[model samples]
Target chain A: MSDDRIGVRKTYKLAIGGAFPRSESGRTYVVRAADGGFLANAARASRKDVRDAVVAARKAQVGWAAATAYNRGQVVYRIAEMLEDRRAQFVEAVEAGEGVDARAAGALVDAAVDRLVWYAGWADKVAQVAGSSNPVAGPYFNFSLPEPTGVVGIAAPQESSLLGLVSVVAPAIVTGNATVVVASELRPLPGVTLAEVLATSDLPGGVVNLLTGSLVEVGPVLAAHRDVDALDLCGVPAELVTELEQLAAGSVKRVLRPPAAALDWRERPTPHRMLAFVETKTVWHPVGV
Target chain B: MNWEYAPAPESRAIVDLQPSYGLFIDGEFVDPGDGSAFKTVNPATEEVLAEVAAAGPADVDRAVEAARRAQHETWGPMSGAERAKYLFRVARILQERSRELAVLESLDNGKPIRESRDIDVPLSAAYFFYYAGWADKLEYAGFGPSPQPIGVAGQIIPWNFPLLMAAWKLAPALAAGNTSVLKPAETTPLTALVLAEIFQEAGLPPGVVNVVTGAGATGAALVAHPGVAKIAFTGSTDVGKGIQRELAGTGKRLTLELGGKGANIVFEDAPLDQAIEGIVNGIYFNQGHVCCAGSRLLVQESIAELVVEKLKARLQTLRLGDPLDKNTDIGAINSPVQLEKITELAAAGVAEGAERWTSPCALPEHGFWFPPTIFTDVSPSHRIAREEIFGPVLSVLTFRTPEEAVMKANNTPYGLSAGIWTEKGSRILWMAQQLRAGVVWANTFNRFDPTSPFGGYRESGFGREGGRHGLEAYLDV
Candidate 1:
């Protein structure tokens, strides 16, 4: 049975430099629903596209990292609000992509937004919680602050598309590092949709760039990127993890090792995740008259 | 004003330099299996202070095994408060014998006695005391509720400040319940061996802390040892890189406090006289052997001539001679290798057409000595401006505005430290944000505290030492 009225389909594209664009390669892949029905085409992100995303992310990192913590917190919080506004869209996308029941998909969307909110709150407080006024044995003022590790490249988790992607992206960017996220292999529609939400929020362009493509193609390109200061290999396919980790060491890039298996995206998040991508800076000034 | 002061040498009476020394392992002085021995000399006098055993792979293996057994059997299982008492005892004993250690350090490392007494020894003891209190409070250290220590730590220290670096590495490692096998610099292992005696006297577990002294091969063996879970190295960038390459696939945790060519930026509105003092302290302190020494000076173009004049005047007042002299402003270079590096870099500055001005002080003929020197009309691309000379040399560059000053200051790859001299508080804060250094000194320079986390950015290496950050490197989190 078909309805007389045809619905307007949304165009799915890669997010780079704050704009949605079709792949520079003019390539697209069929994204079928769980029932094998036709869905929107997802952009096939090329290696060049990932490089461009890294360039864009690097261009925006210093400004984003320089923003006041309170301002960054408010902007991140605004993203949660936008996600809340588009709540129905994510639930549908998750349900269609992952074959999840409506209730389970709804829980995923709620957790994603809540995760954004939680990371939003962390933006203003991570330094205080992690930093300290060192009781150094001298007449000097000493303090250590947790600073962002510049541009980060993340391989989004393959299993929990929305919640897992948000989990990795939010903690890294919440502390002021710009990110280039390679969406999940099996499921990416929810993540791409989340990118649309990030575009509309007050976040600056290139703060987070999303690319949808084959993990094998786009993952190693970012891992070897010279400008990318850190790599979170949480979603790298099993056989590729060791090679990527080894290549990452050429630049001495800070690495977050991939978990043994997919993490439970529904698990509560903590600040320990944020710490992996921060550099502690100690400042000392003489207490002179 | 011209009358020379009488010889004010600090007596080496209190320290009884042993004829020959053995490695301190498992609370016992043990001979190296290789039967090879090396002499540690006084750079100020070229006199062999003592002979030390050279540890080979077998010795490092033995030490690592001891530390592993101790961590599992004794030190690692001890309560934090109980550990705190042991550290407190070490700190007290250090204070009780700081004078003797200071003389030994000056005789061995060739740094002036006043600095050894005032800066190095006191700071070392202070660090032990500071981290002692932290032993019982790891739960609140931001890693986790019960952050567990990462087992045996293999530490390699530099000749510049051997004992201080040892304290920086060991205090926090012990505070977090880790056992250690420390390797002091080849030329300066006396104070570290002395501290090993203090550890035994404090009733610490036999195998908890071991001092294995030798050169590069010994340190390489320690780094390659499989039993060690962590490595803390304070040395040159080249050595740090080799260490980093060695641990690539091993998953060994490492923290490197490496080389730096820090910049001291002075604005036109800065207090002129105080800025001069800061400039002297920045480059001349510790004979400029400091890793975070402000070797580059960025002065405003409008006041560049005045700053150079004042700096030269201050340099003239600097006393250079015996490191044991209580009043010596600068001491002998640590070794002949270090002196050659300084001589080569200073000659490079002259060849590059920078105007050179060295203090009118005669160097001793027998030992390695370098007078306080500065080069003006320096371009950022010059070797003197870019390299870590690790000696008493300053490269002066001028900028017309605050923006230009920041641009010049951050041009280097090393970000270990930076100094900003400005009367305007807002301007200082603004510059602090722009400077890429790990430690930003607003108006003062060459200041260090155990509470301050110290390290670098870019090729200057990774991880921090000291403060809460120091504890994190030793903990599993």
Candidate 2:
């Protein structure tokens, strides 16, 4: 496993457009290991950082979305490959943060990688699986296609830090929607490391912008932000969900209310679709023209 | 809203609805293959309402086969626009004959006239109208390209809201292009039978929507019917479990809206007067026959006595009598059996040391009736507190802290709906998060809209009805 000491922290900044820069907020929050050891301080993304991520996402999304579903599938597959390559680092991070056994961490890492592959496989086929044509009366050719809801803000699950973050973010991005993921409060190292993988993979910058901070601090900000069209509240605290729901209600943004029970990260496949995260615009032109 | 006697409409002896009613199947009313029939009593008068057909295994088979035949060619291949027009016709006829439907619903099902008129009829129309819109918009509802209908749906509706339940179950199934074999509860079969007439009048294809009647045996048969591809039931938790167990090995899709013992919490800071009104409506609505009725009341300890005082005063204003009366607030128990159950549970509450109080309301001698009941000094572990009595009964428990209120509110296994009464927006938000119930009503209770998802948790059941989520129940995900 490559150690953090080997890579070393050069600068703490927001990773936008595949480069690191100080957050527009010029603020940082220190992350710590479960044992109270200090991890690196992560950038506190401001509204500007969110917008920058959105801009980068807007730039990359067209090309990424226009890429053949099969090619998009391959890019997602690359993410899984990189994740599997760094399996040991993830295992170690989960062990240090969650205080779990090496055996469980190993299984979690395998499951997380397997989840990535599962979603990657669906990148090309979700359109076929979830969209449909209706038996319209006239020759107008009415059909429904699942589209990405656009820029989503996710509060990752606290317990299964990396895997939970991946599960939520993968579905949004694989469906062609960009995301800003708020990493787990108690465990943040694995999340940042996973971000590093996304930076190197074919996944364009701003497709996923990872943040590490107190959920209470950034959750409402992201939920209330108008630019984010949806909120994937997979791991929010029960006491805060209603507030987030109220905030999300302001813009009528879609909110996938958090699951009542904690996630069983190992068993379920995270489904991802290019269409689920983006809207389809069907243009009609006369055949003669 | 005090209980007042209204004479039954001059006998209607001239219009003798046949003593024996048959299952309305394959576009015509027919006797069940099994020669069984159960007598339904008018809960208000204890008179034999009618002898309703008790469907058995053979009857279920016949209905399923009929639906299967319809789905194969007649209904299944119809264009969405054509089906939408049929639904629009049905919706129109429903509005045209809503008064008749509402009167029968109140008479046979024992819900108050106001609710039957204001809620049941309108909601039924809204359901058909809502689903009617979806019929043309099916391709846009997110089912895969070339999404096809799952064949026959075997639906079992509860007694409480007979026609509304049927509307809820059938509207989506039909809109999604599936035929159905629906079994309304034994006690309330009239409205569903009338609905069959409406379907026929709308020129709906024969066997498209078959209405059968019976109790648990019939429901079991419908659930086990192999020809049916999906089962949608709205009933008790016990019956829901039986259906779940029966469908375990079979790959048939199932959606059950089961029992609930929801919490109605009132904080000290709430508008006490409005909270009191919400409390009465929560527990006393429809004789508390509602699945999402707020049966448990958790008051802040300091305000418990004050709330109880206000509740008793409000209870006086709740009228109880003939369900057909527009002014009636509470109505007769659906049946003698249900009334007996409520009485037995209330007796148990008293015997178990809780203070049982009933409003000073007069009761008629013949029919099944229960005054709005409230029990104080109740513990969370009490049977009355935990069990779904499905009657006009409320159990009062007190909490000290915000955390304690949340703990008490979510302690029950059922999670269908809950009510919160507080002025602080932050407190409402905090409490809404902590509560596990599916639909949380702030400062209100027993309110429903077609756009909101409604269901429950734990033993209460799974799968939502209404909203975008409701589409998932009918669609193959």
Candidate 3:
């Protein structure tokens, strides 16, 4: 009897501080395809794993955010380049997890790479787009500049794993923020693979840290972490949004709630997302020498 | 001068007063659930204009429910073109009724008729027109290709610039397809109440625009209502902070246009005449009930004494009292409580060791009034300099260098606006950069256009109120 060629199995692990490692808790949870088939064992991240990821993000934030906007743009653009070269791998992972047709899955992979390029372009232009010189009634030069909001915690989308994850994660880092994301709980392989790509993209270490597991276990840890400056509650469980928001308020963390259910991720984005993750800083200098 | 001029009050006959007013909900006049009512008086004459119903918590809930229904059942389902037509209708009706509205606004809010007629009424109409055009073009406004509305906005406007502030909040809300429950300040609800009639005539669907007039308790109820999708407030910083704290976990969108103690800096090289004119328009306009009023003057130390002398002379020429008077430069205080607050703060300037100067003008005996006053010998730490009195009171400070001028201008927590007057083009640009205020008026003050974005920073609150940026506040994006 002839058998189909055996495909090589891949290990799914957490990527933090530029390296792939299992959860510090040494625990793993099985992720499955929509058809109830075994996909892979994703590292079940604990509070300790979150702490290490935040430390890496915090260590990497200053260097990444302070890098010239041009350099950052090139780094993110390189991520799209890497994503393009490995398109088939992402396509297979997206289909296994989403149960989408092979063509639809390929489109999703292509869209994710395109989104990275979109954000990469914004990296060099955000300051100009959001900043302006004010026409004050004075003899002074006043300008308001948009600055990166530090170290955001992302709860990436659960269903449209690759595209949605890329949508939320890229806008943030391209604008000079570092992120520690809890990738889609049900389907995290594509995200972990993207993190591997990020590791080699000349993107600084800890600039994009990915942990895969039960969001319920890791979400509260990231939300309540004092060091985390912002929380993107996009993929947080509906029931936990308000409670996590309450916890977020303790630190006055800038919170971006999930759009009303009707907001489509596949549509071309506007200027809103980048502006949401930045703070306007107005600086005044006397015009007279 | 008092003996020479006869009574020049603009005809109050133009304003058709109603004996009483009910809360405007779902496109109809309805009584408050609690049956509570308060008298709205003309501050200039101390005569009751009408008895307006005061809203209670239940009333707020009812208004929110109406707004939600309108948002879902009507406005939300309506085409953007249909919404644009409604806004356009409102704008046209406002222009037709501008004269009557101006008289009512002047009577109710104690702002001069000239200002109410030219500035407030025209601007109110202008906003409706400006935002009406934006209704159908929201896709180009940059939120998204198909931007969606956040339903049921709760807006609380202050007594100052009552109709214009209402227009600022309400016009964009409706244009963006969000229904709103607006609470006009109790002291000045007549024009806002009149606006409800305009909304009804414009054929805006039920629950799309509800005006509930009340004071702090009513405003608090509206702010704390769970049904509200967003809260837009233009009032005190203390109350703004309370709203911020109350909505902490609920994740309601909030935009505040709060109090400000803005600085008007005058450089020595400035055209002194124009600088003085800007200073006068800055602090004394609308009896100084403006969040962006240039209440603090930072004059170059070399020219400080001259500026003060000219400012004092300018004050003496200001026509105070009778808001209905077309010639009135400053009008009666809006209310007794506001008068006392102003009185106490002006006294505080004296107690705080700042030399005070009042314009030599007689205030009307029966009504609440305060003469235009300025305090000299003021430092940055003085109470008069540090707090927003919200009256036509100015404080003078001197700085030898532009650095000290910018430093002192930005010393306040309020960054609503600042003024820079200098001859050099580069200097104006440079000064505009350093002043942390949201609206910077170079060689101009107290200027607002429906097309220009306006709001404050820090305690002054968040969100721009006009231009394309204002559209973002009402949209779900």
> B1-477 in candidate 2: lDDT tens per residue?
434555443223323366788997888889989879998877888788788999888988888889999999788899888888898888899898888888878778778878888889888877787787787677776555556778899999999998889889888888888999999988899889888989989999999999889988888888888898998889887777667656643557777688899999899999898899889889888899999999999999999998999899889877777777666788889988898999999998988889998998888787889999899999988999989999999999999998998888878756677888888878876676556666677776776655455666444566667655567677765
Instruction: List the candidates ranked by DockQ, beginning with the highest.
Output: 1, 3, 2
Any runs in candidate 3 off by more than 4 Å, and if so which?
Answer: A1-120, A123-255, A258-270, A277-289, B1-6
lDDT for each residue of candidate 2 in A18-89, tens digit (9 for 90 to 100) = 666777777887766777787667777776676676566656664565567787678888999999998888
What is the TM-score of chain A, computed separately for every candidate? 0.96, 0.86, 0.97
TM-score of each: 0.94, 0.67, 0.75
Give a tens-digit lDDT track for model 1, residues B180-203.
999999999999999999998898
RMSD of each: 2.6, 14.9, 7.3
Model 2 chain A: which ten-residue window has the lowest total lDDT?
A: A280-289
Highest-scoring model, TM-score: 1
Q: Which ranges in model 2 have alpha carbons more than 4 Å from their true place?
A: A1-289, B1-16
Candidate 1, residues A94-204, lDDT tens digits: the string is 999888999999999899889989999998899999888876556777777888988999998988888889999999999999999998876878888888899889899
What TM-score does chain B alone reach in each candidate, compared with the true chain B? 0.99, 0.96, 0.98
DockQ in order: 0.47, 0.03, 0.11
> Can you write out model 3's per-residue Cα lDDT over A62-159, one digit (the tens) per residue?
78977999999999999999999999999999999999989999998888889888999988888877766655444545555666777899999888
Q: Provide the lowest-lDDT 10-residue window in model 3 chain A.
A: A280-289
Per-residue lDDT of model 3, residues B1-477, tens digit only: 443467687897878898999999988999999879999988988988899999999888899999999999999888889999999999999999999999999999999999999999989998999899999899988677799999999999999999999999998999999999999998999999899999989888989999998889999999888899999988888777677667766779988788899999999999899899999999999999888889999999999999999999888989897888888999888999999999999999999899999998988877888999999999899999999999999999999988999989988767788988988888887787566677777776776666566776555766778767788899987
